[model samples]
Target: MTTGRPPRSPSPSSSPDPFQVKRSSVARLPPSTIATSYPSSGHEASVYAGNRSITPTSTPSLSVSSSTSSDDTVLDESDDHDLHTALTSEQISSTIRNEFGYCANQNYRCVSQHNPEKPVAEDEIEEPPYYILFTTYLSYLLVIVFGHLRDLIGKRFAKSSFTHLMPYDGYAPLNSDFDSFYTRRLKQRIDDCFSQPIASVAGRTILVYDRYSEDFNRTQIYTGTTTRALNVASYNYLGFAQSHGGCADAVEESIKRYGVSTCGTRLEGGTCDLHRIAEALVARFVGTEDALISSMGFATNSTVIPALVSKGCLIISDEHNHASIRTGARQSGAHVRMFKHNDMRSLEVLLREVISQGQPKTHRSWRKILVIVEGLYSMEGTMVNLPKIIELKRKYKFYLFVDEAHSIGALGPHGRGVTDYFNISPSSIDVLMGTFTKSFGAAGGYIAGAKPLIDSLRMRGYCGPYAEGGAPCVLTQIIASMASIMGVSSDLVLPTSTSTPISESSVNEVLMPSVADERPLPSKVPASALPAWLSLPPLLSDGSEAYERIRRLAFNSRYLHAGLKKLGFIIYGHPFSPIVPLLIFNPGKMPMFARMMRKLKPTPVAVVVVAYPATPLVTSRVRFCLSASHTKEDIDVVLRACDELGDLMDLKHGRGERWPIEEIVTRSVELVHSI
Candidate 1:
């Protein structure tokens, strides 16, 4: 954390040979590469991949393959001819443009590292036009009034419908009118906008099943039609949600070998060799002493937090934290307090008050205190002020817990999570929790910390004894994706005996690289710790593919964030954040915005629009989750769509310098770099 801004790298314009797309014939990456030995500190063995060193900063040149398939016709049919030509035949055949859009222009990629010399930008929430506010409130007022009226009439006149809301037999109704009001009235109106069914991989594009509600959304009937739409709705951050890729291939092998499940809880013989491998990799990835895996992301917090603190302990949490954090705090029986989201001053003030006041009515020393905050706020798109929080933690002496569910693999230069993004040591935070669902395209979560903390949770936390263990397929996906991010070392030896259980001590025995500034985590995965059967493609094994994914996601996130701001829309969150929330003030516009985007001609785009309950009523918004699988042209389509719809819907109300959609699309690379 140095003062002032770090000088910017030389501008793209300054290069004599600025990024140019050149037509070239390159050798396709062989299915299996020669294993290159990596210098290791321990016993070494032959690696699966070859010794060829690939440039991590630039996109590798891939050419036509010897074989082609009918599925490869999508490349020829794609509108992005330049990209189609640039991709190798193997890539073209394996990747459907609709599933994973390809982009070869290196200028559109940037590293997501923070410059200590530069001050973090203020993430102030912008107010919309006064008229927008008035209309939004009025809209909610009318809806509430009408909703009550409908309930009044329906309860008396529609006795059949009221049967469920009224007492039936000895048992009271499962849901009373008062309890079911919101879901029955307001949510039903926009039901079609949410829970959209899809038929394909939720990658760059999704096959949304077409359906309509004939009975006012009480029920939906399928039309047996599917529409392909550009996807900005899913949590596929680094674009690993693919059917064909190195990760997918590894997963298939895992499934064939281990079937689907471990069949029981960890303590009940559910744990497998894969779990040990994944936990070790996760610990290494996040630069922690050790890690514990959970079957569900939400459960990871809800179950583990209770084990950490209880009764007299105080949990200071961000007001905008996810539901799981709140659940965990409540279940922990800890005295919960809140600070305004990402407001360091408010947090410090609260910290002082709580410290002075002590536990409620006791006026005595508290047992322990934990400050819980999300690395990235899912709903608001704001990031926790980690650097400031770290500084405060030193003074306040409160244990810190960062929920990086949405930040890991999506933020930071090496996709190592928030600690990496802020250039802070992972050891600074007491606990680091993250999920594989968002960035890894897998289904579980992990809790990482000192070996003792994880070991304690394994015994005290409910998940380890009651919940089912991580599935073999899911663990394989995590291992493959994580290893790709942390390239596998060729000189590492594979464990000889499958019967030999891997313990924390054995994993910790792997050599820890010398700690260096800006290099907090190990650069490569200790292939010796991985299962011998798992094999990764050369690009994946070399780390170039994952590096590209990280940089591409960074570029997409910045371009979208900046593009919307320049379009005169009041967007929330850090510029580097992938979750971009565009305020649509009026609740009526939520469904309208979602529908308009989905119905865009030529190529429909799917977006997630959230309203009351998710956010403040007036801040009903459409959240765009950018992914690495998306091409520049895909983002151009989104920007253009937003520009057109924002005008028609009267949603652009920010007081900022504006740019036309054309400029935003044409100068996207420059715009991304500027941010």
Candidate 2:
């Protein structure tokens, strides 16, 4: 049989016959064989037999090799199966030009166009210089190798010594000597134990773990093998923080439609239909003519307060009003005077003093006097005596600004905040500010009040001109939460008894009653005492889920408070308030107790430890916020753990023992003055 071999050319020379075939004396190879040998320079072209194809794998190297004579050219067989495949002459030429830097126009010639002895001009070069190419590859190599090494080391440290690196005992030293002492110590030693994973939602419970069980599951059952503990450290007062309900659904839908941000200030292009709707709903919910929403809850006060009261005004603020209010008061340049927290008598004293003193040095009557108080004090877990404050405001002719950040969705039968809870008129509040972050399952805040006040804010407030507006998704969440509170079918109507317009004469008459009088001014008016006209039923029926959630929250608060008190723990706040504070007087023991509580058996309870700066240094405490989502069983588990841990750490108070409230307040004042 005749093999398929090409016929030999007539002459060896004669323009060096391009199609000449040469066969070796060795065994004939298959047509699929590909030449393996090539020149050292990148210009070498690949050779294939028959119709086998070659494809370019990467950008061709720019360096060229010296040319070879036709007689000296040789090909070697390659074992690479990919090179054995058939290819057309066009593909071969393209591959040679693309991957081997061969000149296809010169019939796959591997010759350098530029002289090696002379430097090529930048205009003549197609590729980067050799030094530049070398540095680029070096950088990529270093990044890849070092990145992998870093990941490996990080993972090892995180799983091992990282968990125990900074103990709570070391934290006190760091806090005390941050600038002078701790700064020079080992950097890792200064890290706080609770620095990682700031408890955002905490779900139903928080997860706590130590070095031994760092990789434990969040829902791990208590077999004492793992350190994972349940969480109760967050401020999800109504269990709305991490809820996956209508509000969440609305937020998702709004995100799809409006994106993540407005990218503009409220007065520019930031305001949306959802924002307007949310503002209207908030105004109606708070029984106000209008409302203004701010992108940040804190900024609502920091910005609005400055706009409302200026140099000519006087601000009579509660001692324990939120830091946001204090910041706003300072920024306002108003004459500020603080009364003892929740102390109505002290407030009256301040009001009388401020009224008598008038403007400082000027000795002139103040243009305006605004009284700022919170519906619920965050650290103290106490509710403001709104009725008494309103009585005082009416008597003293001062505007009342109530920050209901923690109380809006946490208190009252319908979560209408302190005004509704105390059976006081919402109109009595001059500027009712509340945040959506706590109970409404979203961010941003609102300042709801008379139409003129809101209108004034819209025109003159700094936030309107300078700050970005709330995200559309946030507005959707607010609307969804308000809808849930008011129900779909019913309008939110304030109870007639509380809605009565407050008059100076009426408040005087109410406060005139004495302890010995047959009818003393009611400390808190019960729903039963309301006249028939003022005793309208809630929009949601008693059987409704919304009503039940509020009821369950109230029940959980009482249950947890009583349980902790029974365990000999000194508790703070009204029994009805959802926030419960357990006094841990020893600063050193506060973090220790929190860490130990997280290591409890059966289930761990996650509680937030509040220390100096947030609270009095001598009165550091652990705060537990109850939620409607928590079951009776969940409450019981936490209580049981607290009882056991309290005893173990000797943190339990003596029976009927309490922190002297007056003494603590006095010391706190003194400390503040000294500072």
Q: In order, what is each prediction's RMSD in angstroms?
A: 12.6, 36.6
Each model's lDDT: 0.77, 0.56
- Candidate 1, residue 226: how far the Cα is off, in Å: 0.5
Worst 10 residues of 1 by lDDT: 41-50
- In model 2, which runs have C-alpha deviations exceeding 4 angstroms? 1-193, 198-201, 207-228, 263-270, 490-543, 657-675
Candidate 2 residues 503-594, lDDT tens each?
A: 32222122222212123112222221111111111221121444445655666676566566556677778666788888766545666777
Q: Where does candidate 2 have its weakest 10-residue lDDT segment?
A: 64-73
Candidate 1 lands at a TM-score of: 0.85
Residues 178-237 of candidate 1: C-alpha lDDT, one tens digit per residue: 778889888997899999998777887887889988878999999987787889999999
